[model samples]
Target: MRWFWIFAVGHLLLWTAVPFFTQANGPLDNVEMLNWGHEWQWGYPKHPPLPAWAAEAATYLPGGPVWSTYLLSQVCIVGCFWAAWRLGRETLSPSLALAAVAVLEGSIYYNCTTPEFNNNIMAKACWAMFILFAYYGIARGRMVDWGAAGIFLAAAILSKYDAALLLAATLLFSSLHPRARVCWRTPGPYVLTGVSLLLTAPHLWWLVNNNFATLRYIAARSSTSPSWLSHFEHPAEFLGAQLGAVAVTLILATILLGWRWRFKTVDSSAQFTRTYLAWMVLGPLGLALAYSLITGAHLRSMWGASMFTFLGVLLFAWLEARPDPALIRRTIYASAIVGGIFAAGLGLRNMIGDSLVTAPLRVDYPGQQLASQVEEIWSQHSNKPLENLGGDWWLAANINVYHPDRPSISAEQDHDLPAWTALDAWRTEGGIIVWETATAGDNYETQIKALYPNVEILRPLEFAWTKNQQRPPLRVGMAVVPPLAPIRTAELPTPAQH
Candidate 1:
């Protein structure tokens, strides 16, 4: 238990501190989320509202610290670690329970990719809680436990609609377990279902009323060719990615607990716990594969966030039949080695990435400078504060996050925007527009002019960003269209209303 807390706290600080200093302006999703969070809604075009709500809530601290969001991401990550610890402790020995969590730090999903406080990270925490509560509910037949499971399941779905894939897996497990099957007749399961539906009712209504915009966005993002070859190609690609993601953790676990597979005496209690872990982990992967095969959907690597939550427990349970302090110590050593390598690798990448003159990541974006210049230009033209921000998600998100007023975003080029504010309202209260320079033969400026024909196009501003002293500077081109008319409404959405 002492070691578990040490690993958990270390994981939290390492993840939080690295991104806080190394990332210049934070990742694109983090900025985009803060932009969405400026206004609260039941749903956004690409995902549900929970992630945005979480991001918005974090800004309530005195300074609205950028590191707070990163901290929030780590908080979610630590919650996942704790949930896995709790679940394993109940089913397995305490040492093995700690091992279950220790092994996961090496996984890229749990540590490397967690710095970005995106929907994927948020979903992981909710998914872990849902699985833990579901296990307790089914194992103990407790109504309170089942209710908590339902609530977290709803949170998972609200984090990303794809979480329904995991929920389907849970339903499959309920049917297969003899004891859990009896839950079908009890009010607990029914009430659990009701609780999930009740919590998600608003988002579901938004989906229907908006013509399932999120589904459409996902289809566009994941669309592939209709050829028969793609069915095989897509699923194979997905499987390969999944395997690669867990490769390090799998290798380390194999070293700690060799190729032997053992089962506890066919005790119903032991079997139930093992089955729950196996089914939840395997069921989702199966559904992902099925979806890939049937729809030829391009499965992104991030979707693997919840797939390996119970993998460590499964590995430790099969390898260690009896409590062995020596084996547990060895597992801890191996975990530190693997986790250290992962952390060191991440730090090296961030350090090297800052010096790369070519192919810079979003973390290198000079959002603060751009926001300052744009706002300065806007003040010259209008007495009112910047109320509306328009452009692409990346550029607009950059300005919105740092701009003084935290303007309402208007990514008009991107369709399926939720009615965070009325279009008429935007027209009445004109806003600043910003976009990158056009490449050769590109007419992004012409398109922006066409959209807002009444406004004048300001001279393009060429800003150079070089965070690391060793790197050659990056040149970014930006143009701003200052507000034409000013209208301030008492009804403008603010973080406080959320």
Candidate 2:
């Protein structure tokens, strides 16, 4: 327990502080989530509402620094560690349980990629909690435990629909395991089902009202390959990616157990624990791969983010190896080394990325400077606050995060407006449309003209990257849609007049 706390606290602080100081702008997903969260809707076109809600809540904390999102990501990672530790302690000795949690540090999903604070990060924590409670619910037949399990399961779903994989795994295990099947005769399983349904009702209603936009997004994203060969290629790639993701965990386990460890099953008395761990670790992964094989759907490597919380426990339980203190100490040292390497790499990237890479990274985006300039341009045309913005989601969202008014992204580059955005109100209120001038080909101009015939294209503005100033200056193109009723005496000329 002592070692676990030391590792957890160290991990939380190291990860949180590194990104907070190093990143000039929130990553794409983080800012996008913040933009969606500002609307406070039950669902978005691309995903469910929980991650956005979490990101938005983080921004409202004291000082409302951008680092709040970074902190939130660490909190989710630590929560997962805590849940894994607690679950491991149920069957393993305290030191072994601590190792189960510590070994998870090897997985980049828990550290390197977590600073983004997206649906994947939220799902990780919810996945761990749901598994922990679900285990207790079945093993102890406690109604409260069952109810907690349902709540977390609903949260997992709300975080990302991928959580349905976890739910499927739970149901499959319950139906197949003799010990778990006994719960069906009791009210515990019923309570879990009812609680999950009740809590998820609002989102389900939203999905129906919106014509299942999120599901449609998932379908569109998955059907990227139509070639028959994709059926074989996609599943193979997914499996390989999973192996790579867990490579560090395997290496650390090898160090802890040494070459003497044998591939032996646990004793009969602990068979239930071993089986449960196996199901929890493999069920979601196998189901995902099977779906890819059947439908030829392209599986994203990151989608497996929440599927490995029980991996270390499963490995140890399957080997039935007792780890001594010396082995645990060496494993902890290895974990620290892994974490330090990642942290140092990120810090170096932030400090010297300009010389290392040709293209500007997302963290180098000049969000604050861009927002300040956009706000200035908007001030020249209207007295009303910049209540709305239009154009690319990434650019608009970055500005939305830094602009004093925190304008709503009324229109996206894809031209699909969010449900919360009232087109009539946006046009009447008037706002600016912005895009990268370098990427604003003829189509962008044609689209803007078609949407707003009276739009005035502003002079392009150029700004240096936040970190890599040596890179080409970012050139931003802008256009203003005049309000229905003019607020200023000077009437801006239309594109035709120009």
Candidate 3:
């Protein structure tokens, strides 16, 4: 009881310290995360509903910012660590259990920036719950344990398709283990399967409504590897990252496994062996390697496996082979500090925006800034329809999303939506076309200069970095175009005329 209290207190304290930590006053992430609060469906276009669902919960917290969702994610991760400790203790010594908790929760990688608060979080939570429950039912012979296992397995799969890979590994390891045949005959495993299907029904409905987009996305990612390195780099990088995240414990486990198998005679310890092989040692790393070889696709790292920390318990247990109280105490402090560092890193990412994931942090919309400058120029020059050039769908969408007033030519496609820009056909007069990478807010100077090569550049779009704390580097600019020739009405009909 005292040890459990200590672990719980440690977990709570670590989470409490960094919830408010942010790099800047404002969060700099794209609207994708914020957009999550608006609705809930079985699945989102990009990720499963878990991250967004958690985001919804955070929104209800006191003065909770969008970044709060990331913190909530840690709550789920720490719970998994608790479950792992219990499993370790049941099979090994109490000291190894403590060590297992430390290894699992010590790192910043899993709790900090990873398992982004989306489907990935859902996957982790569900998978961990499944592991915890599976262990419970199998060890204790309870029907409730069976039910929980099924529910979690279903939930994990709903969050990310890759969880199915873990499922396969779990069954394979269970069957290969010494008691594998009897483990399946029990009611516990069956209950878990039934519960999983019940939870999975909603996802099935979503897949139907979304017109099989999820299926396509799943199919695309399921490939193991490709001929070119570029195609394979993503999965390979993901593989290396997972190893690094839990490298300390994994190494210890490998070294200790031989000893445990040889010397340990306890039958209950066999469950721990199964868990080590099924979840930590074999499940994730094995699945990633499989995807690389068979799927021929760039395998992602966090595909339903962020609970690698549990494998760390085996290391702590091995270290416990010495039974030195002083060593254990020191390891505890080190793990706490290490875990705190990782937790803080995650908090920082949420507070400042995930700059590590995104580059430059600035987004472009069809000449959004330039459009405002152009409108000002047109007002000065009599609002006469002007011929424009270099406008694309990317620019068009930005004009619509940001500058609703900046009219431009855009067709219906990826960048073009039902905006006023495309219908405002008055911008077809082709004398001095305005196109610039950057320029000052003005009229026709850019167009006039571009038309006349000898013209001195006066007002170019000025770019400045926005001083947002939560965001990486960001800059915005505006430019002007000058009318070179007299307005040609025969060719430049009024917008109404067009």
Top-lDDT structure, candidate number: 2
| Cα lDDT listed for each candidate | 0.77, 0.83, 0.52
TM-score of each: 0.90, 0.92, 0.66
lDDT of 1 by residue, 1-498 (tens): 787888888888888888777777768788878877778888888999899889888987755446778989989988998998898887787888888888887788887788888999899999999999988888888999999999998999899977888988989989977877988887888878999999999999989988999999888878877798889898899889888888877876765566675555546777778778888888999998898899877888778887787888877654554466787777778887777777777767776765655656678777888888878887887788878776555666788887778887755533576544465645566776665544312665565555555666776676565366544443333434444433333232211100
Better candidate number, 2 or 3, judged by TM-score: 2
Compared with the true structure, what per-residue lDDT tens digits does model 3 show for residues 455-482?
3343434433232434422232222334
Residue-level lDDT of model 2, residues 1-498, one tens digit each, is 777888898999999889888888888888888988999988888998998999999987875547888989999999899988887887677877777777888888887888888999999999999999999998888999999999999999899999988988889999999988999999998898899899889999999988898998899888857799999999999999989998998888887666677766556647887788789889999999999999899998999999998888777777755457888777768878888888888888877876687778888889989999988888889898988777766677888999988988754423233744564755588888888766656566766776677789888889898877778898888888877733332212222100
Instruction: State candidate 3's TM-score.
Output: 0.66
Q: In the order shown, what is each candidate's alpha-carbon RMSD?
A: 4.8, 3.9, 10.1
lDDT of 3 at 165: 70
- How far off is residue 19 in model 2, in Å? 1.1
Candidate 2: misplaced stretches above 4 Å? Answer: 224-228, 263-269, 413-419, 442-456, 485-498
Q: Give the TM-score of candidate 1.
A: 0.90
Q: Where is model 3 poorest over a 10-residue stretch in terms of lDDT?
A: 489-498
